[model samples]
Target chain A: MLYPRFKHFIEQKKMFSLGETLVVGASAGVDSMVLFDLLLKLSHVWKLKLVLVHVNYKLRGEHSDLDEMLVQEKANAASVPFFRFTHTEKSEGNFQEKARTFRRSKMEEVLDQQNAACIALAHHQNDQAETFLLRLLRGTGLKGLGGMKGSSLSKSGKKYIRPLLPFTREEIEAYAEEHKIAYRHDASNDDVSYKRNWIRHEVLQQLKQANPKIVNHLSHLSSQLREDEEALEYYVEAALQKVSISEDFGKCSLKREIYNSLPKAIRLRLSAAVFQKLFLESAILSADHREKIDHIALRKEGGKAQYFLPLNVLFTRDHEKIYFQKENVSE
Target chain B: MLYPRFKHFIEQKKMFSLGETLVVGASAGVDSMVLFDLLLKLSHVWKLKLVLVHVNYKLRGEHSDLDEMLVQEKANAASVPFFRFTHTEKSEGNFQEKARTFRRSKMEEVLDQQNAACIALAHHQNDQAETFLLRLLRGTGLKGLGGMKGSSLSKSGKKYIRPLLPFTREEIEAYAEEHKIAYRHDASNDDVSYKRNWIRHEVLQQLKQANPKIVNHLSHLSSQLREDEEALEYYVEAALQKVSISEDFGKCSLKREIYNSLPKAIRLRLSAAVFQKLFLESAILSADHREKIDHIALRKEGGKAQYFLPLNVLFTRDHEKIYFQKENVSE
Candidate 1:
């Protein structure tokens, strides 16, 4: 069932075209190990060319190196091409942010060398649940709170695909164990100091104990949310089309009458859409910020500037016309 | 902030017409109690009349009677009419299901007595999240998993409004505590035997403890999902208008080519729409059910009996004419 579902997802996304290689990010974890093995088995059936990539961040010292060795041995057994990268520099900022940047950069390099059509990572359902929780903690808006995308474009313009995203971590572990697949253990996963780790070790375990199907439930929720999210984007696009007064040099103005007339929920979404167009980040706009913007559009006097935002967008009223633009540099 | 938002929501929905009384189902719980007080306060400003209705299921013995007393006292203090009903019959089915049915019936009776324009309930953000989780667990499709609506029409044709749907349970609790509003305690809430209660007590609490802001975050996710759900509906409606062969006598047919060409997500949504028109219930068409219909439509058969889903709706094929109608009695 897992293999068939993975095949269907890969084919549906067209993750790999004819003669184009796929770069798999193998972390030597059960999830990634299972994905790597499945891809190895299905490559002939699907006519897929595979390139294995592993990142040794050196954060775990000898353990990380051991994991890289395991992945290399697995790739050797499968007679597949493999690439490995080691990063010695300590990540200065957030561990999650730094790890993400490091992984993406390494993956891009592998893609360029292999000319891979897509980079596949083994982010299963539990990962999605953790992500949803993380985004919620950070006060994310609709898009940010949506968790992970099945297929997204990386920073370097390479396609990143998660074919096993809908599967739970437990399922992946069961598959790996049943197949006698050897994988590395990441000590950081049990640290609990990091938010994701805490969610994984404490929160998710408790939820699983209570329900025994928490990951599946959360994954289902994400898919449902994803569907709803797409529908919302359409309506927001429609509202944007009807209400946008001007868009020049990435500065846009939405007609006040049009903006004010929308329901508050729609108004908040529209505001987020406008900011997304300029900033390209899905920061949660506060309700106060939305209300302030609504006030500017409804009550503020002419020529008065009102700073309404998450991305610091400003709405300046000039008689009946509401001029919207990025805030001045001085302010 | 909550009161103002509630006021804005009620006014926007036009839930109560001019000179018509509004009935609120005030169970004296944190949610309904806050709603009761807020409506009482806003009634003067909005020029509206208010009536409070309470249903004591008598499941919790003394606790249930206490809740009724609290609601009646509060209504009396506000100089508003109060209505109370007690049910001695124990629920034979699930406790939540029985309570819901009883509450709705009581609300209807109160509405009739007051000639109310709408019946209001305090289903805050947490309730919406739980509903979403429950529907997802049950393998529900887009519409069922979409959660609660801000406004809906009851089966008895009475308007139902949930002004606090966007507000989180924490926010309502904070407001109630801040205003020194007295609310009753429902022992059943902590039972954790029911699926929703388990989610509320176990899953959500774990998420909240990890993030400390999970309620608002998940609620934001729901709001975004709602927007997406609306957008999907718009596209579905447009597609129905363009590709629907016919929609008469509670039966409809869609062009196979048009249906297959739609994005998979949209195809699932269209199936849901078609099912909804016939069943008036979104639960009948699961994800697997939609896929089955899609599979039937894709098969290159000339004319055959199409798959009939859980509902009594029978889908058949007549060469180019794909047909959907209620199952014939003789068959």
Candidate 2:
């Protein structure tokens, strides 16, 4: 049985093309399994060429292999293509982030090989809320609090979609049960060592006591912030086009007076954009760093101010202009 | 001794002018008393003519009067002008909101009588965090989550300032204890009947367990939202000026094509501004309402759409223009 709400959501959001090849990031968990089942049902009507893509991280031993096997069996039953990628890279620093990045890269490779239109991920409303809470606790700014986008283009120009984002975990679970879909439960979800798991078990439950609809409220907040962030980004892009004097590899300069006239939010974003243009592709600048650079740009009594950003970029501000360059590079 | 951080904050933010008459709303609570003491100490250095204004809501019997008496006594000892207003009128609904409105009106009256430049209120960081949570649970947009402004001009052109907004409740209490300042604790603060108190005791405490710096994190989030909001408002104001075709006392007609081209956040704000221009002074349209109107405006095949907003105003969109007028008003 097709979940009417999820079907309506996908139709309304135009999450995928009617007859395009698409990749599903399936993990045999309730979230991804439900998504896979729904897409298979919809594919017949929408003329979608469906492909199930699973990543056996091999971190959970036999459990990960079982997850891959289940997804492959379902894909075969539905008469759809199935692809499995084995993750063998040892995670350093944050395990979840590393694993997620690796999964994304592997999925993009499959997307290219299949000539797929986009990849669908099963990040639901609860996942969005968890991301919001995690970012909030980490001292994030507006963009971070906005959480995941429903559809975003990757660096290599591949579109990624989260069709299940509007539905809560409870709703998805109910859909799975009503449809009698079999899914594997990952026990690691309860292991509190994962920061997200800690927040899910300890923090969200406490918040739910105050407001039963806490998850919905948080997701709503994220939507609001996302809208605002997009609006600001539009203006920032316009401002940057006018204020930026010159640009090159690893170096750029912007007019000081014109930049100062923009809003603080726009100024910070403009600085980040420049930093991204200069620094490595995967580098992310903290809000505090962006703010420090903004202050350097806007100071009234500036003679010649200089600061080193976290990404090892030298930011210099003078009376006429602000410049960014590689830290060790000479003028 | 004065608070160095506050002094620097004032200098940086340009919160007040030198040698001006200012009114401080002293409630005799630890937050306000500490503010009172700090202001009294800083007045001589800044050459400020200070007035202490106390509102006795008379809701708590003798406790209300005692609060007034203590504040007045402090004003007398400091040799600063003092004014007291007795709020005897019974509240109708939402007593806190009613009392707050009444107190604000009375303070403006005092300011007019004294020819003061602005009135100061001691709304600290924790109060800000509580407000963010309260508004979040109640479903607010970016503006509400931004929390209170450090300085805002009232509708009547009176300025209200919050100098203690950067400090937390504990910080204020510590300052009060260090200065040997006597302050009365309002028993009403412990009343869970009030939603703000419920959140403070229940929600915030739960959040604190996950992250001890929850209050600071929330306030920081507010600051970020506030900056983003201000930037969006700037663009919205500019957009409204260009889009508005005609305006009357209680009606506004805006160009549909131009309005549709704006960002969603700006579009929603422009709609609310039009609603405010046509409806009651205190009327506020929710983000959901604004979003619905935006959807109606942006529909690809539009004929004619009408929505009855919360403020009893009719929002009409035709092929050429959008109209806002009182519900019963004939076109």
Candidate 3:
């Protein structure tokens, strides 16, 4: 029953190109298992070549190995290509964030070798709702509120798509049950110590008491914000094009009057984009940094007023131009 | 203690000019009672000529009269001019909506007669959250998500301000209790059949179990959306200026290419603005009406593609220009 919904979503959103290779990120969880099943079912009709990728982080010992084995077996039974990546090293900082980075990089490596059209992930509507709530808690702007993009292209032009984003976790679980699909349940998911786990189990469960369709409403909100954000970004890009006077490898200049004339939203976006370009994604420019830049631009004083941004990027304004320069430039 | 926050909000938001006649809507509820007390305390410092308006709907017989008498007594004690408006007749349609309209009209009449600077309402953070939830449940876009504005000027440029918007209902109630402010509680508010009351008692109360600060967070979301909406509106206005060729009473002309070149958000806003201008507030241009207009403009044909927007306004687009004309005209 949900198959038609998935098909319609893919067709309506044009999530992937037909006759193209696709990489599915599977962890043997219910979400990934359902995604893998659906994609496999639609492969011949859509002319899709499915490839499943599983990474064994080795954190859970036997459980990790069992999950990987199940994913590989499912892929092999479906006659789809299966690949395994081993993670023997652990990184500092948040474990989830590090694992995501590792998985994305590994997937990108595979995508480059296979020239896959897109890598599909199993982020359902519940995940979207959780992300929305988390971002709200941390204080986010409109772009953050837009939540995850349905399809995004990486720096290497590899497309990443979330085909299950429109469906709720319950719906996916129901579909898996109806199809009698085999999946591995991760015990760590029930541990509410993790922020996302807490949100999923504690926060949303309570919210559901008020509105049973809270996840649906949150997903709808993200969709609305996404469209509104695209329109805003389009205008921001245009504003950037109009104000930009010159650009180099790690520097750019904008006419002061023209840049200041832009609305605050566009100004913040343009400045952040410039910082991201110069800093080469060292870190996202913080709201505080943007506020300082806003103040500098508003001041329009030429000499001795330097505004420092994230990743050692410093901006100084002149009577005519606002200059973005790296503090420790080698050249 | 909360006075400084209220004072700072006024100063930061520029809600109204100080030392001027200000109309306060006092309903004898705790929310309004707190607002009245705070304003009276600040009146001397801000040099404001405070005026209070109480609307007695007479729905509760003696209770209604008692509420009005309490408000009048409070105003007299504070040495503020008091005005009472009686609604002996009930209007058709949704009672809440009609009551709101009637109250606003009556307040406006008082505002005009007193030449007040602005009319202040006692809508707090809880009301804002409830409205946010109600809007989500009923299906809304960005504008609806933005909730209520801190200050808005009506069609006739009569200013209305919501000073208590930044404070939660609990905060207002606490203030009232601490100060021992006499207020009449309306028993009808406990009736959950009313959509807003249901949201307040059932929805938000349930949501508060998850996060005690949910009301504050919801208010913050509205504030963020308001800023984003402002930026979007700025771009839309700029686009309108670029595309509009001619505009008069019940008619407008716009360059097709320029209008189509604008982003969807801006296009919808521009078209809705034009429709509003032609119709003169006779009806609100709905999303469906705007979508139809968008389709008509995209078709690029002259005769067969007439769109009837709300309030009997018609739109037609040709190869070069989009024309807006009222349904009936003498010429």
Candidate 2 lDDT: 0.83
Clashing pairs in 1: A228-B228, A231-B228, A231-B231, A231-B232, A232-B227, A232-B228
The global C-alpha lDDT for each of the candidates, from Candidate 1 onward, is 0.75, 0.83, 0.82
Worst 10 residues of 3 chain B by lDDT: B242-251
Query: Per-model i-RMS in Å?
Result: 4.0, 1.9, 3.4
lDDT of 3 at B308: 64
lDDT per residue as tens, model 3, A1-331 = 8889998878856898789899999999999999998998899798899889999999999999999999989988999888899887876778887888889999988887888888999998998888887776665667787867688887778799988988999999999999999999999999987767887998778567657998988887787687688888897778667644444546687877888888777787788887776568655787668877887877733544677776677788866678788776576
A1-331: candidate 2 lDDT, tens digit per residue: 2467777878777778789999999999999999988888888888999888898889789898899899989989998888888888785697777888888998898889999999999998899888888887777778888867778898888899988888889988998999899999999999987778977888778677668998988987897789888899888778767645344446678888888888887888888877775676667778878888887887788589998887667889977888887755455
Q: How much is the lDDT of residue B75 in candidate 2?
A: 90
**After superposition on all CA atoms, what RMSD does each candidate show versus the true structure?**
5.0, 3.7, 5.2
Clash count of each predicted structure: 6, 0, 0
lDDT at A132, model 1 = 65
In model 2, which regions exceed 4 Å deviation? A244-257, A275-331, B244-261, B271-331
TM-score of every model versus the real structure: 0.80, 0.88, 0.81
- Order by DockQ, highest first: 2, 1, 3
Residue-wise lDDT of candidate 1 within A1-331, one digit each (tens)?
Answer: 6788888877765666656688999988888899998887788876788989898888777899899999999999988898998877774677667777888888888888877788888988898888865665676655554556788886557799888987888788888888888998888888888888987888767666546776777776666566556656556677777655444544676667787666555666787666666655765556676656666677644656657554556656655655557665673
Better of 1 and 2 by DockQ: 2
lDDT of 2 at A261: 87
